[model samples]
Every structure is written in structure tokens, then in C-alpha cells.
Target: DAGVTQSPTHLIKTRGQHVTLRCSPISGHKSVSWYQQVLGQGPQFIFQYYEKEERGRGNFPDRFSARQFPNYSSELNVNALLLGDSALYLCASSLGGGNTEAFFGQGTRLTVV
Candidate 1:
């Protein structure tokens, strides 16, 4: 089976712009696997959706949003991008909820200028 995959591996945007990142989980997974990694920090949870419903969210502002698709893939959208939003956005795939082991993708590196 394929591991989780994310698109555009890298991006660059200006403040106030919007961006969308994509993710596809392992073949049979049905959960969310989204996180943000800063220069020297651990991954920060962003969103988690299971069975097409939102199950968890982190302390991110409303500028961040996401949805899991019927096929188990997901998309993360960030509006009004800020310089602080520049980071490596990661995605993972799990069998069910947060407790399950997850497989991660290469991540999307967004650089806000």
C-alpha cells in the first residue's frame, strides 16, 4: 500500500495570500494526520478528521481549515497567510483515531515572504 502523500512539496507566498495543501492517506486509513513543524520545534497538531467528520483541532487560528474526503484523502487550507505560517506542513495516515500508529508523508514546505 502507498504511504501518505502530500502535494507541491514546497510553496512560497506573501502575507495575506491563501494556500491549499493536499494529502492522501494510506490505502485503507480513515483518519486525519496533519501537523506543522517549525524550524526547531516538534510537530504541532493541526487537524484530525475521522470517517469524514472533524474529530480534533489544535490551537491554530480560524485561518486554518481542513476536511477529510469520502475516499479518506484530505485537504488543508490556510487563509491570510502570515510569515509565521512558513513551516513544513506534514500529513500522516492512521487506521482510526489518534492512538493508532501513523505513516507520514514527505511534507509541504511553505515559505511565506
Candidate 2:
């Protein structure tokens, strides 16, 4: 059983360009969440989708968006990219709501160059 898988482990984009990051959750997992991690700082929650519905969001700008598919796969979209957006985009999956243990993927390293 795959814990969590993220594609295009690395990405290079110029400012103002849009990018989409993908993730696949473990079998039987019903919740998928996205987090942004910048070096020297902790991971910040971006979005959480449960059963295909968004359940929570973080203090990120409107440029960040995400959605979960019926199969439990997820995608994180960032629009109008900026150099500050360069970071590791991580996806985590959990069984369900309330105190569930989450599992994370390797993360996509987005570089704004």
C-alpha cells in the first residue's frame, strides 16, 4: 500500500506562471491535505479535503487552491507564482476526521527562477 505519492518531485517556474502539483493518497484514506514548507521554517497547512469536500484552510493567499478526487487523489494549484512561493509542497493523507494520524509524501520542490 502506497503511503502517499507526489509527482514531478521538482519543478522550476518563472514568476507569474501557474503550477499544479499532484498527489495520490493511500488506499482507504478519505482525507488529503496540502502543506507548504520553506527552509528554516515549519510546514504550514494549506488545505485539507475530506470526502471530496474542503474541510479546512490555512492563512495562505488566494493563489493557493486544491481539490480531492473521488479516488482520493489530490492536486494543489498555485496561481500567479512569486519567488516567495518557492518551497516544498507536501501532501498528507489520513484515514478520516478527528485525531487521525497523517502520512506525508516526499514533497515537490518548486523553484521560482
Candidate 1 lDDT tens digits, 25-84: 988889976899999999999999899999999999999999989999999999999999
- Which 10 consecutive residues of model 1 have the lowest summed lDDT? 95-104
> How far does residue 113 in candidate 2 sit from its true spot (Å)?
1.4
- lDDT of candidates 1 onward, in order: 0.93, 0.93
Model 2 clash pairs are none
Q: Report the C-alpha lDDT of model 2 over 19-97, residue by residue, as the tens digit.
A: 9999999899899999999999999999999999999999999999999999999999999999999999999989994
Question: Candidate 1: which stretches are off by over 4 Å?
Answer: none
Counted clashes in each candidate structure: 0, 0
Report the Cα RMSD per candidate: 0.8, 0.8
- Give candidate 1's error at residue 27 in angstroms: 0.2
